[model samples]
Target: MHHEAFVTATFKNLKPNDVEFRMSRSSPGRYALHEFMKNVYDLKVTDGNGNALDVSRPDPYSWKVNHHDGTIKVSYILFGNMGDGTYSQIDETHAHLNMPATFMYMPNLQNQGIEVTFNVRDDLKWKVATQLKHVDGNTYYAKDLQYFMDSPTEISNYSVRSFDVDGQTINFVLHHNGTEAELDAYFEKVKKIVLQEQKVYGELPSYDYGTYTFLACYVLNASGDGMEHRNSTIITSTTSLANGGMDGNIGTVAHEFFHCWNVERIRPQSLEPFKFDQVNMSGELWFAEGFTSYFDDLSLCRAGLISQEAYIKGLIGTFNYVWNSPGRQFFNPIEMSYQAPFVDAARSVDPVNRVNTFVSYYSYGSMLGLALDLSLRENGLNLDDFMKMMWTRFGKHEQPYTVTDLHNTLNAYAGKDFGDYFFNHYIYKNEMPDMKRLLNNVGVSLTQDQNNVSFGATIVHGIISQNTIMGSSAYKAGLDNGDKIIKIGDTVINDSVDVNSIWNTYQPNDQVPIVFERFGKTQETTVVLQASNVYNLSLFETNNLALDKKKQKMRDAWLQTKK
Candidate 1:
């Protein structure tokens, strides 16, 4: 029943005037504005002599302390009940601490070193797992505010597994309801993914503290999230490892670990020194996040954790999602990256159609990654080489990079003209690359499922919701997006009814009686079903003898694991 916790920060060497203390409006991995100060209350401030200080709150996120001595102590109580990689929670079981959501800092002293000490309850047995350098029994050290905020602390008596690679120790701290055997098996797959990702970059990045921690909280009540840090990551999920949830968990682990190089170290120029008070938007997240998405599944296939068929199925799913999204006609990958602050975990009380003009940077970027990889392969190069080059030029040196840096690297390796053309069409403009042609070169077939019939409307909530009528049969039948489909040929629509399966029984051009409810009025119409020209991409059967030698060589090279 412990729903609240207290935090006290003591500031020394203050300016002896008004100093502003603030909780972050947004966090690093989280693109949405959280307004963390909303959950904080009972703020108290005092001087070194224990005299109350004059505090003025200019805004909800900041508090201005006036009439303070050179040293001041500020304390507040925080209320948190939800647990994820981005939010903090304190309960009877454990304390999940996200620095940005739990700690308040002075904007002026952001570059100063910080030391944090935890006062563990004597009755509770909790162990600490974080990337922060340990000073002694209960204290930890961080070089700067950016480093401190990126580190998430998990104080729980969890099971731990350790492995070493390239002179660095990787620790997996798990607090979940899973057996030891299941945990060990999952760790083995994680090790393989780590090895494969390291191989792509040619080497692991220089860890700041010579250790990387995977702080995972897999509980039935926790929300799913995985946030990448400088030397570690926080992955929380409601799924149990003993069940069928390990595969999805592995995908998140691989994705965040890949970000250790892509977003954490490679560094977007706009987000280098992260802004806590405002949204930090970058145009290169197409590579920072999207390319990482591309490798998340590819690494699994390379690790032998998933089959080639399964991997291709995943790719086809992405292709279907991105290609079908209407936003592609209006926004490119770079534009979508810029839209992340508005769409990533965003919520709105009013209805505005985002489906018409919002493509996920993650999905679109992965599609671009696939297209570029195959395109580069046509020129005797691969995406792996490009990543390694970026690691050397920007990531290894810890230099902040921009879209221009990416273009320059691509031009240097794949020719100036080709790079210009690729960026112009795929990144600058809303033009998708020739996926069919690119995939064909690798012995894969990208085709559309023409046999599938649909009413040409995307339905939701067991009703024909907004944005449903997209020039399909439903649109032609005078049924708008807000028209709720109540019945189809006298068969009443309900939660159990599979709308697609119902339409599958009929063919294109077949007229069917449809009844819908719209704005408190019942309407009837006849909809002529149309073929859903959805892309269904798959690799050609490799087990047979009809495969071409050159195509087989290409596929082999594409799927080969680097050592």
Candidate 2:
């Protein structure tokens, strides 16, 4: 990968001479402030006649151009190596362009239309795939800067498989070194996901220009990310279709596809105008992102691309994470959502206590979605009806919604008392729902693992890694992160053998002497063990528990195809 791009922008008919052109610090679908200007250098500004124009930097991100004519052209070298939803990557394989990280704009000219012509590398044989309206062969038009920033462009020697659905074109552009058959197989599943998500909302959003595009780069150089936009989505992964990605990458496809109706159009009022100068935070990400996470796998299940058992098993990871975390004592779903700026793919070098303090809104909200789905099913209704109601109230006309609006909509769909109780206990506070009873209602079982014991922390090569769980026996023994467990209960730690097997030799509530090293100092303590809180899920039939046919019918309706 070359990892660099030559960018140019021309602003004509300027009303002011001292115009400010700057790089955005944030991008669509991201909440962190990126120092995009750090990757920008070799900048040169000129007039219409190709004369040099004087420019001054008032801040690190913005450049002020004074004593200029009505027109000024800005060109620079943009270095991008990270290929994901939030950042751009230019390489010999492809140019994965995320606009805020790639382009510079005139802040004052927010309403001005944009015409971009990508100069494709002829030797690379690159072509353009973007949601922007095509003007000519390589040129495209954006009605405004918002649309332009939202439209991510993928230019590479890529293969495309397109289909027509509901009078709209859906394009899947793949840049992978895979066979044509692999692309066809993957695209087939992609098509099924599209239709199934449409069934959730009862219809597809009216995509601009009658088109929606999925710009996918499944190559070795790209990062694994899936970001949603207005009429398009960018899904990048390092795994190719043949290398476990055929099944692994479909969940991202389903998730981002659901966003076209949920977060993309069924919008959050706080995130309506995404500011690029600083971090943008919203309390409603539990709904915008969490609910989408909940539906990602469910949509695939409804599409018949995955089995019900597979879907049920898939919930185990996220469900356990949310249900077992102690972070809920500090924040509700909304408060945890506001922490996106620090946690959403953004982290600091210094060590922090997110292990004890944070729970991902994605997992938390997915479990909540699961709870709501089953709770509604108990009342002879379903989440689809609530979502369809939300779609009509907030999505169809593109009206953004607040927390009260969501509560009111739920009230209108389910009931006032039901909505208030759910909001008060689950959204405002941190109490979990009757997940055990709810799952049992649909013939699913939730039980803690009998053989599992709490080791407090994950271990790697005789060293204690990650934050030890609070109130765990290991914590009571004063073991912490970075402690090297030289011996556990008189068993010498060995690099070759599995340490977990040695730990499993001892049962829960047993106490033994432990030796560890921290900061190069050896220490000794007697540690008491505790049972792990981790749980398991299985169908009643799988567990040999008697299940009535009515519960089977309920399970079928929950996971079966809606269309």
**Which candidate's TM-score is highest?**
2
Over 1-563, each residue of candidate 1 has an lDDT whose tens digit, in order, gives 56688999999999866888889998888777888888999989998988998888798889898777798898999988778977898887778899999999999999999999887654667888889999999899999999898899998778889999989888899988788888899899999999999999988988987889999989886789899999999999988987666887999999999999999988889897788998888898889999999999999988888987788888877898788777777677888898988887766798866767787888889999998999999888999999989999999999999999999999988999989999988888978878888887887888877777867676775676666535678878888777788889857888888887788788877889998898999989999888886787677774343558887788777886666
Q: Compared with the true structure, what per-residue lDDT tens digits does model 2 show for residues 1-563? A: 46889999999998755799999998888877777898999999998889999999899999998877789899999999998998999989888899999999998898889999999988999999999999999999999889999999999999999999879999899999999999999999999999988988888889999999999999998999999999999999999999899999999999999999999899999897988788778989899899999999999999999998889999999888998787998899999999999998886899988888899988888888999999999999999889999999999999999988989998888899999999999998999988899999999999997566787778899888888877888888889998998888768887986877876888888897989988989999988888878888988888899999899899999999886
Weakest lDDT window of 10 consecutive positions for candidate 2: 449-458
Misplaced by over 4 Å in model 2 are: none
Model 1: lDDT to the true structure: 0.86
Model 1 CA RMSD to the hidden true structure, in angstroms: 1.9
